[model samples]
Target: MLLKYIISHTRLNESSVKNTIKLLNEDCTVPFISRYRKEATGNLDEVQIGDIVKYKEQFEILEKRKIAILKALEEQNVLTQELKQKIESCIDLITLEDLYLPYKKKRKTKAETARKNGLEPLAKIIMSQKANDIESIAYKYINKEIKNVDDALEGARHIISEWINERTDIRNSLRNQLERHAQISTKVVKTKAKDEKAQKFRDYFDWSESLQRIPSHRLLAILRAEKEGFIRVKINIDDVRALERIDNRIIRSNNTCADQIELAISDAYKRLLFPSLSNEALSKAKEKADEAAITVFAKNLKQLLLGSPIGEKRVLAIDPGFKTGCKLVCLNAQGGLEHNETIYPHPPKNDSFAAIKKIASLAEAYKIEAIAIGNGTASRETEALVKKIQFKNNIQVFVVSEAGASIYSASKIARDEFPNYDVTVRGSVSIGRRLQDPLAELVKIDAKSIGVGQYQHDVDQNKLQKELDVVVENCVNAVGVNINTASIPLLSSVSGIGPKLAENIFNYRNKYGVFKSRKDIKKVPRLGDKAFEQGAAFLRIKDAKNPLDDSSVHPESYKVVEEMAKDEGVTLGELIGNEKILQKINLKKYETQTIGLLTLQDIIKELKKPGLDIRESAKVFSFNQNIKSITDLHTGQLLPGIVNNITAFGCFVDIGIKESGLIHVSNLSDEFVKDVNEHVHLHEQIIVKVLEVDVSRKRIQLKLHKK
Candidate 1:
């Protein structure tokens, strides 16, 4: 039953989804199932598997709600056989709630009071559409409390209003009308018009747009403004059309009873239905907007995490500053901090000769192969100063992005790693290590603080955190982790090793030297077979006893590889990377009940490049020498830039200036660019033509260069 629902919702093959669910229910992780059980899942990727898991969870929640509702209805003695069946057949939460609303218990209302006063008989007479004298019927029910015909008729109308509000067809029709035609508008708060903080929301002060057509970012902005008390937001629809739709569903005749019913319809819509449905629509819209924003954030984070690394190079990193001296740290090829110092290369000090002497001496003394300067405060000056130093050994200089360096400096992770050092020293080390391996170092910091998102804080925090964690997990596993050298945070991102297990593994490594083989992980306390099965493939061990340990080949599949090497008349090491022998072996011959052609093919590929880093090597980038700030930019001049952040509307490029330039979607290519990632990526360097520059506002506009 659940399989059909998921297949219908996702429009995927039923058989594949069924098998994927089976694997998931067996306690297999998404990464493990997608990578190892490819044949069973029909080669579905992690995204499809994730969707299946999400929808299954949603259905489980709905089922639980249904059980609770059934229990409530049964307790109230209103659970008829037909109503029970109708509730069980419901597939949508909104429709199910609408069906159950009439039976729900509530506080004392005007309708309930009227019913208590013996006016329900008159309401039923009016609803019958056969009563020609509603006033007479209402007068018959009038008691000492009811003064006149008008008072009695008003009581009947109130009862009828509740009836109209509870009718399923009337509620559904009115809801559909509002969803299709509602417009959201905002107005500035009159009293706070002159406030400076409120002025930032000026764009939304007089904004009005169709709720259905509003973009996610704009909706979030207006909602944020409303939340901050800068503006009042309202959702409106054409009242005449809305009333006509409700009246058509409720009124059956033009008699005296129909007149009272018309009044009841208007009261129901204005007082009860419209407000409730409009709020529901707005809540749904907000959820969709949050999902869209979170998806974009997840994509940007994946790119940033998988960014190219400069790999294992001895680096002298500088955290540039003007007031305090520039914090410098010298790191070895293994990313361990060897030395740290402070140098004043800019501002009041102007100690150029001394700074140059110190840098050159460090390069020669530490055998530094590259220089990584944090792109902050005095970055340009530091880059220029470093470029002039004449080192005996060749050194490549790169200005690395320090988006979350400050956050990481003060984080508990940094404090634990560098107990003796201060924040400045820790920050320099993060900058240098990011250049060496972006994925490993970035896992230690929060994904939101990386600054590659739009309105990140406004989105759902739990959803954002979950999506970003998935991206981090996938990237960490894709690149594979060297268990011996990886940090606890990096190890925690592996497929099956969570925070607790990661701590255990770290402690085990500390107690007993380095992990000698993939199987050695099992010896750690609390590390069970299931954890080893899920994580062993993604963990690498260099110089292990078994050559396959360093590759992505699972230990369970080691026998197949051993058999292949035996058939090829060569040792496992000789058979690895030997294309002639690997190609000569028939993959189908090794297939068994558990293994298929897909898994066997992956094994062959892994043998070719044992434990290869899937990411590209980082390259040094130079910005346009003439431009350093917004004031230096001119219209129509072509300049080199690197894409710093991307959004649905456009991409922001860093053109060697403090202020990044915007490349709107329309100008991304000669053809219409639907997805910005298709044209550029995070940290991608490209040439752009400057189109406009607003120095006062500090905004630059540019167009992508045509191929």
Candidate 2:
């Protein structure tokens, strides 16, 4: 039953969902199943597998809620066979909640007070809509609780309102109306309108838009404004039309009882129904907006994490600044900090000659093959200074983004890694290491702090973290980890390894020696068979005795590859990377029940490019020398820029300035732009024509340059 619902909801293959769920239940990770268990999942990618996991968990939560509702109904002695079946078969939370609404516990309210006054019977008589003289019927119920016939009728109306509110048909009708016709409107709090902190949200002070048509970023902005006491947000619809819809569902004739029912419907619509449904409508919209924002954030994070890496080389990295001077650190090929110092080359002391000599001497002494300068304060001056020096070796200079570097440097992780160093030196090291390998160095910092997201802080934190964690795991496993050199943070992102297990592996390696092969990880305490099965394939060991250990071929498939190698009359080392021989081998001959053509094909592909880095090598990028700041910009000027951040509406470009420039979606192309990512990617270098400049606001508007 749950499987059918998941299939209907997700539109995924039944067999694939079933197999993926089974693997998930048995503790297999998404990366492991997608990479090594393709046969079981019909070649579903990580995204599809993740969808299955999501729906399966949702189904479990629904079922658990059903059980809780049933238990409560039985305890109340209101459980009927028909109602039990209805609750048991309900698929969604909203529907199930509607069914259980009448029985839900409530505090002291008008309806409860009316029931205590013995007016429920009179209310039921009015609901029947047959009695013409309802005042006389109400008179019989009058006592100390009800002083007059009008008072008795009002009490009965309150009871009737509760009944109307509890009706599933009525609630569903109102929900449909709210879903289709709700408009979200906001108004300025008069006092906050003049507040300085409220100026960012000034545009939304008197805004109104269809809830369905509003963009996610705009919705989040309005919500944040309301949350911060700058504005009052309300979800509204045509009240008269809404009330008429409820009336048509309840009222039967033009009699006194029908009139009483009409009055009750009005009370219900005003006091109970519309307010509840309107809030629900706003909450649902916020949820959808959050989902869209999180998806954008996750995509941006994946691109940033997988950004180009300049492979292992001796590098001198600089964290540029003005008042504080530039912090410089020399990192060896393995990204270990060899030396550190400060240089004031730009201003204050005007020590350009001494700073230049010190940098040149350091570069030559450390045998620096590449230079990484952080794209921050005084970055242009630093780059210019570095370019003037004539070096012995042709050292490539790259302006690496320093987003989240300061946060990571000041964090406990940095303190643990560099106990004696200050935040400045640690930040400089991070700049250099990120240039060497982004995935390895970035896993230590919080992704939200990386500055690639749109309205990241406004979205649901738990949901964002979950999604980003999955993306990190996929990216980490996609580019297989070097078992010997991977840091604890990097290893912790592996398929089944958590922080504790990663620490154990690191301690084991440190106490004993480096991991010689993938199999050596099994010796670490608490590293069980399950962890090994899920993680081993994503770990690489260089110069191992078994050449396949350096590749992504799982240990379980070792025998299959070995068989293929034996048939080819060569060793595993000789058979690997021999595409000519690999392609000639018949895959059908090696197919087993567990290992089908899909698995065989993957095995062959892995043998071809064993443990190849899936990312491009980082290239040196220099911003236009003339455009140093916003004041240097003008309209119709073509300039080179790098896409630093992507949002739902557009992408922000870094044009060698402290403030990034925005390229709205409309300016991206002549055609309609659906997704910003399709036109540009994070860190993509491109040429843009300046469209407008608001120098006072530090805003630069650009359009993609075609020529």
Worst 10 residues of 1 by lDDT: 133-142
Q: How much is 1 displaced in model 2, in angstroms?
A: 1.5
What residue runs in model 2 are displaced by over 4 Å at the alpha carbon? none
lDDT of 2 by residue, 104-125 (tens): 9998989999999998889999
Question: Which candidate has the highest TM-score of all?
Answer: 2
Candidate 1 C-alpha lDDT tens digits along 46-132: 999989988898788778888999999999999999999998988879888988999989789989988888888888999999989
Assess each prediction's global lDDT (C-alpha) against the native: 0.90, 0.92
* Pairs of colliding residues, candidate 2: none
